[model samples]
Target: MKPFRRRSLLAAGFSAILSVQHVLAIQLDLQSTDSIKAAAKTLAGDMVSYYTGYRPGDVPGNLPSPYYWWEAGAMFGALVDYWYFTGDDTYNAITTQALLHQVGPDKDFMPPNQTKTEGNDDQAFWAMAALSAAENKFPDPPEDQPQWLALAQAVFNTQAARWDTTSCGGGLKWQIFAFNTGYNYKNTISNGCFFNMASRLAVYTGNQTYADWAVRMWDWCSAIGLRDAQYNFFDGSDDNLNCSQLDHIQWTYNAGTFLVGAANMYNFTGGSQEWADRLNGIIGNLKLFLKNNVVYEQACEPVGTCNVDQRSFKAYLARWMAATAVKAPFTYSLLKPILEASATAAAAVCTGGVNGTSCGLKWTEGTFDGSIGVGEQMSALEVIQSNLIDIVSGPVSQDSGGTSKGDPNAGTSSDIGPSDLNVGEVTTADKAGAAILTVLLIFFVAGGAWWMVT
Candidate 1:
């Protein structure tokens, strides 16, 4: 960056533009990340400030009124990541408040006594967030504050009692109530989230029982075609009770939960090629959440419409996909470019409201069409936050054909996966200059979205 080197970058041909582009790219990346960082902090603040409350349906950044258990749980998961990425205390405070209100007298998260909606899957979502907070060492509020790990454990215990082997070779049913629509359905979200939670708990507590459960869940899910050979995750099997039919609809969160579990299994015990392959396979199909390589909900988007749960799905996918990078660094090279490409696309879609900054469901980069809400805000916040993780972890190489050796201390990781909820610094490989540049150009085009918001 000396004067001569700077001038040398500015020659008059296509070569010159390409030569100087790298220099410009550096400034642009910093701007983009800065914008992302600032936006994550502010939007998170806005969500908590405006939407969440003592009522059942009040969690900000969730779709559908009167509070849905899983959606609120999903929002808390993102809040946990925001805490780790930026050390923002507000997210922590809100999370504590939300949990305090939601965790009922029995320590099950009933949420304002909305017991009818308390599916095991819905309840486990809260536990997953608490486990994440516990892993990160988020301070307990007071002695009065529920212990995070204890809350998560309680959730697991609740699910364990419901495991029915009588049908479909054993998977947790979607609903706790026998008469509910999904009651007989052994769905992927319930089983998948349980798999992820079991994997984390196996590492955290060094309990073979938890590890065994993780293994069991993985086997059942794979055998049932919920987590299939193609790495294409299907929605849960319907309530025919036979488990022979698969729903086949895919969601961002399904991949998120299953891949994170696979990555955790790889990290915790090592030499699980099956697990390693599963992780790679899912990473390969991440375009399920992307459009032209930029991440999208893939279910309801570009039409600028998404249903209650679908609107909030991408945040979990983005959050845990970043986690997968940490849990299996060997895959870092594979994950980085896709994530950066998507983040850059996300930055572009956020525009033309709130000081030229509005978040919309459609990620296909055009000016924002004036639709804005909590779910849109969070979808943008989570993706941008992952981009920040990319910058910190630095350049990553795709892990090639070599077998995964895993962590040297797989035994220790088996007991305590990762460092306090950290993704750890992913090692760099050869830089993907073009990919990074593509990201920067999109951010440059959408530069005002970030800058004008503040």
Candidate 2:
């Protein structure tokens, strides 16, 4: 009886393991274009299912609660790539409408509704989406609507004006408005977005000035230790501490952001060794986020501590890595296999939810992690569609039959006046006067606080 029971227990355990291992339901034949497009289409459709932004009474460009505005912009950006790669026009109309509606009066991404909650990083995500549209030659808006390249330039101009030398020597603040919680923090994402846009714009317009800004932003980030000697990009630092120490938590999106920007610089410089070295430095350290060649959120995925935002980070990494391959073809051999492994793993976990294909956060497990949302879906869609990278047409520039228009000074308001703007030039007297004004302001604030206490 004891011998029979032991054999039965072993059989049951084997059967249980087999049952939990989900079959690969997403049929992706990487070798065949038809097969790849079909798989990506289904995944994109499934992703769009969670988006209620276009529904009656819902805001057009904003994802529902728990998902932030920046992500919705990102989703549209992914859909633009989807259309570019797969020729699927299913999501284009709504994508265009959402983008146009959110351009705000300044033509930058800072809509009035998001003023209280929007950070510099938040606005940059939207600008990046618009830039993607221009690069992909996504259909231009009707003649009256804001042009895609101009919108991106507007964001670049506004952010350039906000570069804060007051804290951490130099870097953009995390938040746009003073009342926001992270206003005092200088973050990699904000600065990286600026760098990314600058590099891409440099490539698109053949503009030396944009390239210079890209170099400046990269130098500033490295000097400040946001990027360490090992190429591990840390999160952000407290301006209160003068950025002496970083947050030290590495996020996949931060690394991805810098990687794509560096790749673009490589293309802009006609394959400069400096940018090539930077790219290698970044990818060398990126292995920490990959498990079995599959991309996962390193910081929070393992511990199951990823909040709503962190869950979607791998999507950016996957998409940007694909872009990096296009900008610098040498990276294709390195990034392609990783992208293929990740896409396959990402597709396998889509066996959850009522549709039997809701994506989960962890792609390495090959089974649904039981989580579902816009992030998971976006991650899946990006990795899966990105498999078509090598076959699709690469991005174009103004010199290469591109048609998107741009304005160098799109977002600068005339009302601010030249004297108030410190971006261009400042004499010694200007610095001395600013220092005196700052001292007087501090004294008055202290005096006001003392009076209130008394």
Candidate 3:
């Protein structure tokens, strides 16, 4: 009877262990790719509706006027890429319509007044790339293709005309607004965007001028961006009073854009160790900024006292980090642990419910409910779903046929079923772990107190 009881106990323990392992291994299919595609489609549909029927100067979702240019440009690029990868004609049609709306008579650009800034030139890059790609894909070009290309060319020409070598070590001014403000500071974000756009433009149009601009811009940024002693980079301009350096001296987006810009330049100009070194430096600083299992901005200090505003920036940081992890060399190994942690955290939060609808981490309490106006869903989506994994895993080199071995959906989770446990239960587990640690510390303190008293 005693032997039988022991055997039963052992069997129960083994079963418990197996159950735990099963939970750990269970990857919830968030339908991430599908979700991203759906979101992109929804956004594109909104753009089409706004452009075709809405009142003049009307915008979607009450977004500020300054953001419209970049937002539309980015959405256009994303939709274009989605269409390219999935061959979804719906996305293609919407992008074409949206681009056509911006094209005008005599093939001159009629950029909505809202998008007039040269700083907003990055949007044109994305827009042009998508439109040019669409024209290439469909041999029967749209009537508006020439108009669109001409518009893009004009915008590029205007921006290139503004590039002055007199100030800030020979780079483009940050923006027209900055120029007006007398804030003619050279910035990493602007220069990086310049490099990215120029490189892509060079590739698409086969213009060595674009390629030259990209290389010159990248070389300028790399030389000025890095801080040798700290092994980090700044956002540009040494004016510490510029609010660009609030707390942490390092930022994920700055690092990410620079790294990506470098990678894109390398793609066009062939590989360079200088670019590789710059990318690695950004990655190194970013890795150092990760603390308490969370990526924080190193540019901000007194980490614990930092305001909740850090949440939004951190989301951007995560997205950039994930992106960098996938794109930069020798960085994937470092990214795996962080990605797994983020995935696990997201899964833990998303567990339970019939359709698993409530599992997402809300940046704030009322953003989704239309209260308090504190939501930015796209940032969350960008961080969670964008192909950062591809950067880390590295893409298979394409042969002459333009085929590569990297599968975007490879190793993705297929299980989308609801979890047996609720989010409350997950919260309880976290609280319980914290409580245990607190009690242990208290006990140690009490023991020390007693010894001193004796």
Expressed as tens digits, the lDDT of each residue in 44-78 for candidate 3 is 34333323212233322123432444445544544
- Candidate 2: segments with Cα more than 4 A from true spot: 1-24, 414-454
Tens-place lDDT digits, model 1, residues 151-247 = 7777776676667776888888887655345666888989999999888777666567878899999898988889878888888886475888998
> Pairing residues by index, what is the TM-score of model 2?
0.86
Per residue, candidate 2 scores C-alpha lDDT tens digits across 356-391 of 677889998878889998899889989989999978
Compute the lDDT for candidate 2.
0.84
In model 3, the number of clashes is 13
Off by over 4 Å in 3: 1-68, 84-92, 103-112, 115-141, 146-155, 177-183, 203-208, 223-231, 238-250, 288-375, 388-454
In candidate 1, which residue ranges exceed 4 Å CA deviation?
Answer: 1-33, 54-67, 302-305, 352-355, 390-454
For all candidates in order, the CA lDDT equals: 0.67, 0.84, 0.44
Better of 1 and 2 by TM-score: 2
